[model samples]
Target chain A: MNPIAQYPFEISVEKVLKSSMVADPLTLLDCSPLTDGAAAIILAREDIAKKYTDTPVYLTGSGQASDTLALHDRSSLTGVLAAKIASEKAYKMAGVTAKDIPVAEVHDCFSIAELMAIEDIGFVSKGEGGKFVQDGQTKIGGKVAVNTSGGLKACGHPVGATGIKQAAEIVIQLRGDAGKRQVDGAEIGLTHNVGGSGATCVVNIFRR
Target chain B: MHKTSVPGVWRRFKNRYQIVGTQCETCKTNFYPPRELCPKCRRGGKISEKKFAGLGKIVTYTRVHAAPAGYEKQVPYAVAIVQLEEGPMLTTQIVDYNTDELKIGQSVRATFRKMYEDGDEGIIHYGTKFTPIRES
Candidate 1:
């Protein structure tokens, strides 16, 4: 999508359910669309960052991990092993736990993936993500605001730009520039980016 | 025409004809699609060809209602992850079962069948597929 997108229609659960089925467990609504978009961030050292802006969001921690290429080689289908490993590394570096995060942007390449990623990244105990979402815990005012940008589902996934787009969402949330979608008074935020069905995963934490 | 090299298919005839994989003697590990060396044991383990009897149970499955590219005619086919008796799992299409009837832990056995036709006049590719093992 372009820098500013104007959605012409409304999205609801009923419309999604009525959408065409691409696969038995996954529907056309569940999959992200291939969008034409691009995102860029200017990184600066502390001294240079201070020269540029007074409200520079700090990149506190980052972690990356990989899993077996073959899905059959994986131990479980319900969780992403790489996401857990990567997020743990990031949390350890940031000196914070999942409870400290008030806002997050996770890879929602598919709806089921969002459920699995929240569990893998330790946002909620394993198997609780489904229930957590069902109770409206991921909304803007809910327990921990997730995917405030409507995630990849509605925001559009431009493959390579998806990761940076996620980070940009967190940056906006942490800097209090996200407008109505902002998680109120969010000081720390996190973004999770995945590649090719959990073969690769990356997590980054930001603070302002 | 979706072209698949004859050499590529020819090389994997063993795996396509039957469930032939590799096993490491040191750690008693099995691999499907085979491996050049043991991932865990590496140079320390003895590797050999292992022929499996193809009996297994379904771990998970999906019916693909949307086929990609040249496979548009094969929509709504059943695909599943089957855990073989030898411990390794394989991703294969499930045959001879209703798409809605596929279930987790359902007993299954491998069967050889035509995988795809390259094009209208292209060669027919054959490979192993799993089917539900019906009880008498």
Candidate 2:
């Protein structure tokens, strides 16, 4: 299947042939480019926000964790342990299972990075992220829309600005304001952000 | 880190290869590269010998075709974290294979390689790096 055609919006793979070669099965284009951008969100008590906008998303939960930065230092390569901790916390706080999230925005610094992220966040089982994406289960109308924002691959990775960008994208999805990238009736959404090779991971949940 | 570095520190260790860091006795947290104090706890940390284990795995990695000026000659090199079995991960270059052969969970070991020497000062920089553990 054409992975690009799986999206509800126009998204393209931006591959930058030159950069540092950090690992194998990965390329500069597959990684998030160092960038500069900003993302913001407006949240209030559900009742209070509803009074003004009639469409206020709920910030149900948030979690963050850190791990060793040395990639080889880890005991496993299947997925990030930091992400698992963050997701576990976020899911517990939101009182929603990973299966409840219909759409999500995850930090995909590299193409392989994205594959691991979806599994870490509970969207799919371990080692199956690559296949899940290749199967188009991550498209807008598929099992769950993943990274409709073009992700860090196509969009850009503005370090400090990405966390907020994830939140803002979730808000857009929850409010049905995502225009071309809208995920049908997305009621619950999630965002995952990582710093420096999954050494740090932040997971957040939002509900409409 | 230029703007953040002290004036003479770089010159003091100009010719030597060493990693300075603080250790927290309370938590036994060893920070490499370096840090001011133990971040896990609010207590002050003690300075100590922090040589790291030079072996680990290629949990994940990437290749860069573009890099900083000093690293231009090393463009298209692999950079990754080698998680030493003893604990702690080190960021360094992974060498000796086609980029396509790099795989997650691959075993690796660390080595020291000369990163280019300074032109005028001739200050040579040696840092820890990784080489793939060739399978038998």
- Find the candidate with the highest TM-score and give its number: 1
Q: Is the docking of candidate 2 incorrect, acceptable, medium or high quality?
A: acceptable
What's the TM-score of chain B for every model shown? 0.88, 0.69
True contacts kept of each: 0.95, 0.57
lDDT of 1 by residue, B47-134 (tens): 9999998999999999899898766788878888999999889999999996445999999999989888888888887789999998
Which prediction has the highest DockQ against the true structure?
1
* Least accurate 10 contiguous residues by lDDT in model 1 chain B: B7-16
| lDDT string, candidate 2, B1-136, tens digits | 4454443565465213443344566677766555556665665555555655556676557676667678878877887765566456567778776655577677887666777767757666666677888778
**What lDDT does each candidate get?**
0.88, 0.75
DockQ of 2: 0.36
Docking class of 1: high
